[model samples]
Target: MKRILVLLFLVLCYTNPSVAQLKKVTLEEIWSSNFSPERLESIRSMNNGNQYTLLKSNPNNLFSAIEKYDYTSLQRIETIVSTEDNSDIPYFTTYLFSEEESAIILGTQVEKVYRRSTKGIYYTYDLANKQLKQISDQKIQEPSFSPDGTKIAYVYRNNLYVFDRITSNRTQLTFDGLENNIINGIADWVYEEEFYLVRAFEWNSDGTKLAFLKFDESEVPVFSMDRYGEDLYPSQTVFKYPKAGETNAKVSLQIYDLVTENMDLVSLDSPYYIPRLEWRNNPDDLSIHSINRHQNHLKLWSYNVLTKKLSLLHEETDKAYLKIKDDLTFLPDDRFIWSSEKDGYNHLYLYSKEGELLNQITSGAWEVTKYYGYNPETSVLFFQSTENGSINRDVYSITLKGKKKKRLSSKSGTNSADFSSNFSFFINTYSSANTPPIATLNSADNGEEINVILDNALLRTKLLSYEISPKEFSTLSVNGNDLNMWMIKPKNFDPKKKYPLLMVQYSGPGSQRVANKWNNDNDYWFQMLASNDYIVACIDGRGTGFKGRDFKKVTYKELGKYEVEDQIKAAEELSKLAYIDEQRTGIWGWSYGGFMSTNCLLKGNETFEMAIAVAPVTSWRFYDTVYTERFMQTPQENPSGYDENSPLNYPELLKGKYLLVHGSGDDNVHVQNSMRMVEALVQANKAFDWAIYPDKDHGIYGGNTKLHLYTKMTNFIMKNL
Candidate 1:
C-alpha cells in the first residue's frame, strides 16, 4: 500500500508541478519591479528615415548614451554621444536633437516641478565639432533649439531667455516674471494641471520670432501644504491654485521680434483662456486657440507677425464642453487636420488654411483615440482608434479623404505605434491581458512585422513559475448598458465554493478601468487577492470614456450620481453569480477611483461591506477650475450637484468598514479632503480607519511607501472583507 501511494504521488507531481512549486506574489516583489517587462526607452526617429536614436543607460556605472540605430538592420550604428567618453558632460538622462541635426541638447540633474513640468541643467552638444556648452548657469525649462540651430530658448525662474550659440551670449527676453505673480514662456499650475499645457512658448519657423503666453496669477488664490520631510520642523510649500468659479490667472499671448527687439501683447477681445499656440508653415502667421470663461465656446485665430492683426480662423461651440488636445496637425500645403466630436464621436476633419470645412477625414461610430501624423509623400494618415472594440485599441491608416481606411495593427488588445519621420516604417508596441509588452518594427504601409525589438520573453518565463490567474474579460448588462468588465478568479477556483467579490473602479470622467491591456501594479495586487481565494473585478461604469459621448457625458452636472448608481447596480448584478458571496462584497480605488469607492460604501451601504479610498477628492469643489467647470460647471451655479453627490453631506449613512488614506503633501487633491472626512465621520459618531503619509504626493509612492500602503490595505481586506 505504501509503494502504491508513493507511485501515485510521483505521478501527480509530474503532471501538476505548478501546484507543488507555484509561488505566491508578494507586495515587496511587486514594488521592487521583480515582474517588470523590458521596454524600448525613449525612441526618437532621426531626420533621415533610415535611422533612429535610442537613449540607453548603464545602471552599474550610471553612464548614459544616445546610440544611433539603423532601422532596417535593427542594429546600433554608432554611439552619437555618451557621458562615458565626454569628460565635460555629466550623467545626462535625456537628449533632444536640433531641427537640422547639427546639435543635441542633453538634460542632466533633471527634477520634476509639477505633473508635467520639469527643470534641468541643459547642455548643447555640437555634432560637427564635438563641442559642448551649457545653455544656462541655472536650471531651465523647455529649452528648444532654433530652426537655424543657432540659438536655444528656455525658461528660467518664470522668465524667458535665449542663448546665442554663434556669439556665446545669453539674453533675457522677459523681465516681469515673478514667482506666484507673473509667469512667462511656461504654464501656470492650473494650466499645467487642467489644460495639460506645460511649456507655453513656441519658436517661429524663421527663428526670428518667438510666440509665448504670459500668465498674471497675482490674483489667484494660494494653496499651501505642509511637507514633513526629514527635518527638525515641517516646511510649507505654497502655490497658486484656482478652484472652480475662483479668479483665474489673467492670460495674454505675446510675440517677440528678434530683428526689431520688440515684444507686443496680442489682444484677442479679452479672451478668458488662451490654451494653444502654434506657428503655421508660414512664419509670418501664427495659430491660436482661445476659449471663453464658461468653456463652451472656442475660437481659432490666425495672427500675423508683421501686420499685428488677428483673423478668425474657425469657431466651435459645444453644448457640454470641448476637450483641448494636441492633435492639430498642419500639413505642408497649409491645410490643417483637427479632431472633433460634432457627430457624437471623435473623428478627424480636414480644414482649409482659411478655416473652411474641406472634408471629414475619418468618421465612424467609434472614436479616434490618437491622431498620429499625415504622411505628405503618400497622403496617408495613421491613427489609433476603438473600431476593433471600445475596450481594445488598434492602429489604422487612412487617406486624406477618409476613404481606403486600413487597420495597421493586427493585435486585438492595446496597440500603439510610433511612426518614423518619413512614415515608411513604424514601431508598434502591443500588449494584452495574457501577454507582456512586445515591441516590433513594422512597415507603415501594411503593418507587416519586420523585426522584433523586445518581446519580454524572460518576464513571461518568470511569470510561469507564479500562480497568476487569467484576466477573463466580458460585458455585463447593468443600468441598461453593456459595461466592459474583467474578472480574476482564484487559481484553484471551484464553482461550488463561494468567494468574496471585490469590485474596483475609477469611475471618473473619461477614465477607463476595464482595459484589455497588460497588468499594472493594481492588477498584480488583484491577482494577489485572487490567489487568496478572493474574486477581483473591475467595471468601466457610466461616465467612463471610449463609449459614445452621450454615455460618457451622461453624468455631467452630477459628477458622482450615475457613476455610483452604475457601480452599485453592477455589484448587485455580479453578486447574482453562483460563485460570488453577495454578503461579503467590497470595493477600492485611488484618486477619482478613491472618490467612487467612498461613495459606493456610503450611498450603496447596503451592497458594499467594506471600502478603501486613497487620495480621494471628497468634493468637486476641491478640484481645479478647468477640469471641474468643464463637467459640473461651478459650485455656485450647481450647488445641488456639488452637495448632493458629495460624501461629506451623507457621512451618517456609512454602515460598512472604511479605510481612508491621503498624502499630506498632495498638491493636486489636498489632504483637507481626508481631514474633512475624518472630522465628519467623527462628528457622525462612526467608526473608521484613516492614514496620512507625510511629504508624499498624490501618488503616495517613494521607496517602500507603496509597499507599506499596500500591506496595510491587504491586511484591511483580509480582516474586513
Candidate 2:
C-alpha cells in the first residue's frame, strides 16, 4: 500500500496544475499573450453617428477585415471586406471612410518615412458596388475624399494632385513643387516632429480651395548620412535639416482656387514661423498659428480666403516656451476649443470665432493628459487626466461651462476612453501593472459598461506559471525633489547579499515612465535582468510629465543640466543601500533617455560603472531648430548651455564601460549624434563598443532585430557589470 501511494504521489506531482514545474516566460510569449487576442483596433464611428466599423484581424493570420457594428447593440452584423476575399490587393493598415460613407480609402503596404510621415498605396473601396480600385500607381500622402466623395486629393513626390474616381482622371493642382527645393502639400522634418503636423494642405468646406504651406528649403543646411547596404557601394542620404542656430526653411501660406486655378501668397505682418494652418467652419476663413523666432510668443490669426484679409484672434506669450497641443477643435458655431498651460497646467479654454475668450472649460493643478473629444450636443468635454495619482490616469467628463465634473471610469487602474462620434458611447481600454488589458464598451454619459470585449484571461493564466516579482513603486528624494520611482527585485532576493543595480529612464520633457500600466518589451527585458540576479530601477525626475508645469519646466533653458544632476544624485543615494553593489551600477536609455544616460556616464563617472545609450543626441546643435530652440533657445544665444550640457564636450570623463547603439537610417536624433560621440570617445582613448543597425529607424524594431538587440544588451550587462 505504501509503494502504491508513492507511485500515485509521483504521478500527481508530475501532472498537478498548481504544483507542476513551470517554464519561464519568453519574450515571444509575453508579447503575444500580453493583450487580449480578439480586441478590435482602428475603430471609427461614421459621420451619421449610428454605426461604427472595427478593423479586426484574423486570429489565425494577421490579415484584417472591416466589421461594421451597431452602436446600440454592439453586435457586428456583417463583414464589409476581408483580405481573403480579394487576394489581388494586399491587406490594409487602415481605412478612411468618406463623409457620405459611399467610398473608403484603404491604406496598405505602408512604409514609414519619418516619425509622423508614411508612404502607402491607397485603394478606393466602393461600399455599394463592393468593388476595389487602386487610386494611384505610386504611393501618396494625406489622401482625403472630397466633400462630394467623387474626388480624392493626395500628395505625391512633393506635389498635390486631385483624382476623380468617376472620371478616371487626375489633375495636378500645383506645378511648383520640387524635391529638395520646394514642398507644397507636406510638412518638413522639423515641422512634422515639433509641431505635430504632416498634411500641410487643408481642404476647404466646399472643396473649392486648398490652403497649403509652401516651404522653400534653399537656405536650409543639408545634413548627410551614409546608408550602407548589401550593394558594393554605400549611398548617402542628404536632406535639408535645420539644426540648432542654423537657418530654417522659409515658409509661406498659399491658397489654390479650383475655380480660378490661381494661387495667391499671403504675407503676414511678422516674419515668424507658421507652425499650423487650418480652415475654419466657414469655408472662407482660415486659422494660422504662428510663433516668433524665439518661440516665446504664439499668435493665432484668422484669414479670409476671399478678401485676403487677416485678423489676429488670440495671442499667447510665455517667459519660457509655449507648447503646441493637439486639442484644437472648431465647432459649427465657429467657437473653438483649445488647450493651454497659461494657468501653470494644461487646461481647456473656449474662444469665440473672433477671438473673444468665452470661458475656461477646465482648471486645476492637474493637467489634462489627453483631450478625447467634445460633444456639442451634450455640452460635455471628455478627457483623461492624472487626477488619481501622478502615475495613474482616469477618464473624466466635464460640462463645457466648467461645472459638474464626473469620473467616467470607476476602476483604480489606468483608464483611457475612445469616444464615439456623438459622445454617446466610448471604448474603454483599461489596465494596471498587475492586470492585463481589459477592453469594454461603456456609455459615455453615466460610465455604465455595456459589453466586455477582451479580458485577457489566457494571459493571466499563462502568467501564473512563471515566478515573477511585483514592481515596487516608491518615491525618492533627489536634488531637493521627491521623484517617483519603481523597483523590481529578483525572485530570490536576499537582503544580506549585494546585487548590481540597473537603472532605466526616459527623462524626456512631458513624458512619464513610472506609470500604472501594463509592461512593454522594455519592461520584460528589465524583468529578465532581475531574473539574472540584478536589481532594476526606474525614476521619473523633474523633467518628466504629469506632475505640473513647474516640475516639467524646471529643466528649461538648461535642458540636460538638472535632469542629469537629479539622476546622479538618485544613483548616489541608491548606491548607499547595503544590499546594492555600488561598484557595479549600470544605466541605459533610448532617445532622450539615451541623451540622459550618455550625459550621466560622462558627468557621473564615479557613480555609474557602465552605460548604454541608444540613438542619443550628444549635442543640441545637431538636433532640429524647433525642439532645440524651444528648450535651450538656439545655440547662438545659449552657447554655454549647449556646450556645457553636451556629452561630446566631456569625453575625457567617460571612464566606464560604454556601449552606444544607433540606426544608420534614423532621421530623428540622427546617427551623427552617436557617431560624433563615438569619434570623441575614440579620440579620448576610451574603450567602448557600438552597433549600428543598417537601415533601421529610431525605434530599431524589425525581423530578428529586437531579439538581436536584447541578446547584445544582455551580453553587455553580463560582461560589464
Candidate 3:
C-alpha cells in the first residue's frame, strides 16, 4: 500500500502543469531560426487601401517574389515580380515602388558597408512594359526614383549619378567625390552612425531639383583596423572617425538642377550640423534642421530655393540635449506634424506652413511613441502611444482638435500598426509576454477586425512543449525611485530554496529593457539560464526611457554615475529577497550596458560576484562627437564627468570575475576600449578572461560567431557564478 501511494504521487507530479517533463531550450536552437516567429515581411500598402504587397519566399529556397494580397479576403491576389521566373534579374531582396506606382526599383547583391548603410546592384523594372534595366554597371547606394519615375538617382563610389530610364543615360552630378575625403549625396561614417542618416539627399516634389549633402572629411582623423584574412599579410581598412571633441567632417547643402545642369550651394547662418532636410508640399520650400555643437539648441529653417531666402521657422531649446528624429512630416496643406519633449513628455504638435504654432495635437503625461501619417479626407491622425500604460503600447486615432480619440488596437502589450495609404485599413500586430505576434487587418475608422492575416498559432502551440518560465513583472523601490523590473525563475521554483541571480540590463539613456512585450532572442537565452537553476532578471533604472523626459535625462552629462548606482542598488535590494542567493549575484550587458556592468561589478564589488561586458565603451573620449557630446558634452569641457565614470579609471576596484569581449573590426566602439581595459586590469594584477574576434564588426556576428560566443559565455557563467 505504501509503494502504490508513492507511485501515484510520482505519476501526479509528472502530469502536473507546474512540474511536467518538458524540453529544455538549447543555445543552438536559440541562435538558429528554430524559435523564430513567422512574420509578414516587407509589407507595403497599395494606393487602393484594400490591397497590400509583401515578399514571399519559394518553398524550394530558389528566390522570393513580391505578391499582392487583398486585405478583406486575406488571400494573395497575384505575384507582382519574381526573380525565379524572370531570369534577367538576379535574386532581389528589396523592392520599392515609385510615387505613382508605375515602376519599381529592385536591389540585389546587397552588402553592408556600415550600420544603416548598404551598397547593392539596382535595377529599374517598368511595370507596363515588363522591362528590367540595370541602373548601374557597379554596386550603388540609395537609388531612388524621381516623382515621374523617368530618372533614378544614386550614389556610386561616393559620387552622385542620375540614370535616365528613357534614354539609358547616366549623368554624373558631382565629380569631387573621393574615398574618405569627399562624400556626395551620402552621409559619412559619423553621421551614419550617430544621426541615422545614410542617404543624405532628397528629391523635391516636382523632381526638377535634387538637394544633397556634401561631407568633406579631409580634416577628420583616420581610424584603421587590420583585416586578417586568408593571406600572407593582413590589409588595413582605414576611414575617417571623429572621436569626442575632435574635428568633424565639414558638411554643406547643395541643390542640383536637372534642367539647367547647375549646382547651387545654399547659404545659411553658419549652421554647425545639418541633421535633417525635407521638401514641403511646395517644391520651392525646403525645410532644414540645424543644431549647434552643444546639441541643446535646434533651429528649423525654411529655405526657398527659387528666391534663395532662408528664414527660421521654429527653434527648440532643452537643458539637457535634443534627439533628432524622423518625425517632422508635412501635411497636404503644408502644415507639419512634429514631436517634441518640451512639455516634459514626447508629444505631437501641429505647426503651420509659415512656422506658426497651430495647436498641440496630443497632450498628456504619457508619450506618443509613433506618429503615423494624417488622412486629409477624414481629418483623423493615427498614432501609437503609451496612454494605456508605460510598458504597453496601443494604436490610437484623434482629430485635429484632439477630440473623439479612439483606441484602435484591442489587445494590450506592444501593439503597432501599418496603415494603408488611404487610411481605410491597417494591419495591426499584437504581442505580449506569453503570446507570439498575431497580425490582423482592421478597419481604420472604428478599429473593427476585418480579417486575421497571420496569427503564428503554430509557434504559440509549440512553445507549450518547452520549459519556459513566465516573466514576473513588478516595480522595485531602489534609490528612492520605483524602477520597473521583470524576473524569470525556474519553472518549479520553490519559495524556500535560494537560486543564483543573473541581472541583465541595457541602462543607456532613453533605453528600456523591462517591458510588456513578447520574448526577444535575449529572453530565450534568459529562459535557458533559468532552466539551469539560475534566476534571470532585468531592471530599467533611472536613465531608461518611457517613464518621462525628466527620468530619462537625469543622467545627462554623467553617463554612468546614476545608471550604475541604480543598477547596484537594485541588485542589493533584490538580494534581500528570500529566493535570491546574495553571494552568487552576477551581471552582464552589451555596448552601453557593458559599460554599466563593468562599473557595477567594480563599484558594487561586494554585490556582484561576476560580470560580462561585450563591445563596451571604456571611455567617453573614444566615442563619436554627435552621440557622446550630446550626452556628456565635450570631454575637454566635462573632464571629470568623462574620466570619473569610465571603468578604465579604476581597475583596482575589481573584486569579481570579469569577462571582456570585443570585435577587432568594431568601427563604432573600437577594440581600443577593450584593449585599454585589459591593460588596466593586467597592471592592477586582477585576473580576468577576454576574447577578441578578428575582422568582426561591433555586432561580432557571422556564420558560427554568435553561437561560439554564447557557448563561451555560458561556460564562463557556469564556472564562475
Candidate 4:
C-alpha cells in the first residue's frame, strides 16, 4: 500500500493547521533581541572619498550618533559624533579618524584583553577645537592617531605610551616592559594567539617613525590555567605559551625615534617571525614581513628608517606554508601590490620598488576573496574572487596589465565590497542562500544600483513568522574530492521519510564552511537541527577552501589526515541516502571543529554514531607554535605526524557515543583539550558524555551560557541520535 500511503502522508504533514501554524524557530527566538539585523554600523570613508561616517543609534534617544554619509547620495550628511552632543567621555565605545581628519581617538571603557586585546578609556576628540583630552588614568593598549593629528600612541603596562596632543604630557615609551617578562608594545600571548598579532606597534608613514615588537618572555615556557571565578579558591591564568616543541619569544625588531628620542634594535637576517610591520609610501620605507621557524621561508624586508639600512625586499619559498596577507600595496611608483600562491592560485603580483617581478595582476583557477584596492586612476585592479563559485563571492575589476576583467558583483550570493576612497562608490554587502542581506550603494563605475544600505527586508519579514528549511547548497563526491556541501531538511521534507543524519564539519586548513553567506549563529543552530527532526549537514572536506593549491596542501604533514579521511568518507556517503537514517548517525564540532569531531568519533568508528567535542585539540603536542607548525612540522618534526592525527593517540579507537565539551578558561583550545580527552576515555574504558564550561573562554558563551550549551546539546541529540 505504498508504505501505508507514505505513513499517511507523514501523518497528514504533522496535522496541518497550516503546518501547525508555522512558528518553530525558538531557542528563545535564537537568542533574542527579537531577531536583530538592520546594520550599517561603524562605517568610514572620509578623506574626501566624498564623505561617509556612520555609527548611528538613536532608538528614540538612548543616543549614539556619528552620521555624515553621502558617498554619492546614500543620503544623510552631518552630525559627526554624539550621545546627544558629547558632553565629554561617558559616551564612546569606539572612534579613530585622524590622518589629518584633525584628531579623534575616543574609545572609553572598552575591556576585553585576549583575542585581539583591548582595555580602554581613551579620548582625544578636537575635531578642530572641541578639545576633550583624557588619555590616561591607566587602561590603554593600541590607542593611535599620530599622523600629524599630533601624537597619541598608547599601550600601558607592557610599555609604549605618548599622548601629548599639545602637551597633556605622558611619554613613557618602554622601560623594558615586564608582565610575563618584557613585552613592550602589545602582542605577547603567543603573538596574540599565533600571529594575528595585536598592535605590537606601527605609526610611521609620517608620524615620525615608531615600529615595534619586543617580547623577550624570559625564554618563554609558562602556560598555566584554572580561573574558576566567583572566587572561593581557584585563581591561576598564567602566560607565555609556545607549545609544539616549545620555547619561542625572543622576537626583536624595534624602532621608535620621534625626532630622535631614540630606540633602534633592527638587525634581522631572520627575525624568525615578525609577520608584517608595514609603512611603505616611502616615509623612509619599512615593509618587514618575515616568517620561518619552518613556516617555510617568507622574507620581504626593506627597513631603511633614514639609512639604518636593511633591504632584501622580496623572497617567498613555500613547499607548503608561505601564506600571509593584508596584501602589501605601495604603488605611487614604489610599485608593490602583492598576493601570492606562487601561480597555483591566489593571484595578483606586480612588484618593483626594489624587489623586481613587475606584473601578473590577477589570474585564473579562482581564490582571491578580497584584496580590493589600487584604482591608481583606474589602471583598475580591485578584487574579491573565487571567480563566481567556490561558495560564491564576486566583485572583481582587474587590468594593471592582466588585461581587462570586470564583474562588480551582480550577486549570485556573497558579494562584499566597501569602497569609496575614490573607487567612486561601492558598499555592496549582498548575500544569498535565499538572500536577506542586501546592503547596496554600488556603482564602482558600472555595477550600478545606487542606494539602499541594509535591506535585510525587515529580516525578510521576520523570516515569515519562522519555519524555514532553505540551505541545500551541494557538491559532495566524498573522499576522491568535490566536497563543499550543506543540507538542512525536515520542514515537511520526505523522499520517503528516514532522516536523522547530522554531520557538521570544519576540516580546517584553509577553512571554508560551505559558504554562500547569510544566517550564522551556526545557521540558527542548523535551523535548530532542522526543526528538531534532524537532517542538517555541511561538508567542505579535504582540508577545506576554494578548490586549489592542490586542494589546500593535501593536508600537509597530515594534521588529522585528509581531514579525517574526508569526514569518514563524508559520513559513508551520507549513509548511502534513501532519506539517510543509516542507523541515525551523528557528529559535531567546535575548535578545529572540535578537532574534527574528535577525529570523527575515533577514526569514524564505523561512520559516527554520536559526537560533540566543543573545545577539542586532544593534542598536536598541545597546539600553538604558529598554528601547530603550519600543518604539523614539529613534534620533533612530525612524530608520526603528531601521533597519527591525535584523538589522544587513539583511545583504543573508541566506538561511538561521545560528548566532551570544555572551557574551564579555554584561552584557545585548552581545557587541556578536554582534559586530555577525558584521560584517554578513562584509560579506554569508553562510555561518554562530558562538559566543563566554568570560566569559559574560546567562545563558550558568557550568559545563559549559549543557552545552557544548546540545551545540553539538545538533550544529547534527543538521547543519542
lDDT of 4 by residue, 321-344 (tens): 866778788889788888888877
Better of 1 and 2 by TM-score: 1
lDDT of 1 by residue, 1-721 (tens): 9999999988777567474668888988999999888977868999888899998887578799999999978989999998888878788888989999999999988999988999999999999999999899898999999899999999999999999987889999999999999999999998999899998999999899999999999999999988778899989999999998799999999998888999988988768999999999999999999998778898889999879889998899888888888889889999999988888988999999999999998877898999899899899999999999998999999999988989888988999998899998999999999899999999999999999999999998888778899999999999899999999999999999999999998999888878878958887888899999999999998889988788888988999899999999999999999999999999999999989999999999999999999999998888899989999888999999999999999999999999999999899998999999999999999999999998899999998899999999999999999
Task: State each model's CA lDDT, in order.
Answer: 0.91, 0.86, 0.91, 0.82
**Clashing residue pairs in candidate 4 (N, C-alpha, C atoms within 3 angstroms):** 370-384, 590-594, 591-594
Cα RMSD of all models vs. native, in order, equals 1.6, 2.4, 2.1, 24.8
Q: Candidate 1 at residue 514, lDDT?
A: 85
Judge candidate 2 against the unseen true structure and give its global Cα lDDT, from 0 to 1. 0.86
Question: Could you tell me every candidate's TM-score relative to the true structure?
Answer: 0.98, 0.95, 0.97, 0.32
* Candidate 1 deviant stretches above 4 angstroms: 1-19
Give the lDDT of residue 552 in candidate 2: 93
Ranking by TM-score: 1, 3, 2, 4
Show model 3 residue runs off by greater than 4 Å. Answer: 1-19, 58-61
Residue 127 C-alpha lDDT in model 1: 91
Model 1 worst lDDT window (10 residues): 12-21
User: What is candidate 2's TM-score against the reference?
Assistant: 0.95
Clashing pairs in 1: none
Better of 1 and 3 by TM-score: 1
